[model samples]
Target: MPVESLPLFPLHAVLLPGAALGLRVFEPRYLDLVRECGRAGHGFGVCLIIDGEEVGAVASAAAFGTEAVIEDFNTGDDGLLTLQVRGRRRFHVHKVRVRDNGLQVADVSWCEADPVEPLQPEHGLLATLLHEVIDKVGGEHSKAPESHFDDAAWVGWRLAEMLPLENAQRQVLLQTGDPHQRLQQVLALLPE
Candidate 1:
């Protein structure tokens, strides 16, 4: 469905619906954006500008990202805001409508999920290796399951965004329309 024009905040991170992301609002423009949302009962988009000269300088120029809703917010002594947001949905940005007083507005469209081929048996190896990586990282809630690999989209989004991959690689994953393709790209990142 077509979404109303919304403010955009393109970052290097990807946040899925129901996922929690902490944001430190320091930039004047972004602080204004947050305040506007708080007043308007609306949320902003957090997109990553994969191919842009200036990120956060303006809104419309930012790349695709997920819709996010503020969960908790507090203004600090420095006049900065410490806020937590929950991602709501994925959306494609069309254009920026406003950029003033440290705030930006943009036209956006919601993106639908693309179908993907079922994970093949060999994909289990990729899952196993990822489990090891998670174990190495430690402190995460739990290890990746050793078996039962399925649902390419959930796996792809979860792993692509969660893995310690660089922003460029994560951008590639976000750009792809196919879930299996995203999973395959991430699998390629593993050692042979």
Candidate 2:
């Protein structure tokens, strides 16, 4: 399929397909993006900044990311927006064209998932750490069956949902095509 240009938000986060992300939007440009998205019922891409000056690469740049849809939304009295986003598919960024409103128009193509395989040992360890954290946080997710991590996609999605990492970090995992790599990174960050 031909790549589409999306309004880009270059944060330090990563979002994976089937994972959820939340945002609080106050910037005027993004406010427009959100409003347009809501009005058109079209989803936008969420890309990881990877590495770069947030302001320096506002235009004619690229960010690795995935397509996502806003699942829940609430508007605050202050005119700020709080919305929940869920990753739908992965995409490799080609370039972002700058607009007058400070939002980047990203050119990206959908990245198809590779064949499924078993999770690495580190991935399993990350799942354990996630469960431990859930236990400590008093989250009901810990009650899920032990077999939840058996599927690679399930493990990645579950970890993305359960981990306490910031939005930027989570976005990286979502953009990564290799579920094992995402798992390894999450494992590396597992609470000491």
lDDT (0 to 1) per candidate: 0.68, 0.70
How does residue 91 of candidate 2 score in lDDT? 77
* TM-score of every prediction relative to native: 0.75, 0.72
Give the per-residue lDDT digits (tens) of candidate 2, residues 50-115: 567444445332356777799899987787688888878777778767778887777788787744
For model 2 the local lDDT of residue 36 reads 80
Name the runs in model 2 displaced over 4 angstroms: 50-62, 114-123, 138-147, 160-175, 184-192
Distance from true position, residue 189, model 1, in Å? 2.6
List the RMSD of every prediction in angstroms.
Answer: 3.7, 3.9
- Where model 1 places Cα greater than 4 Å from the true spot, the runs are 1-3, 12-19, 50-61, 75-79, 114-118, 138-149
Candidate 2, lDDT over the whole model: 0.70
In model 1, state the lDDT of residue 77: 78
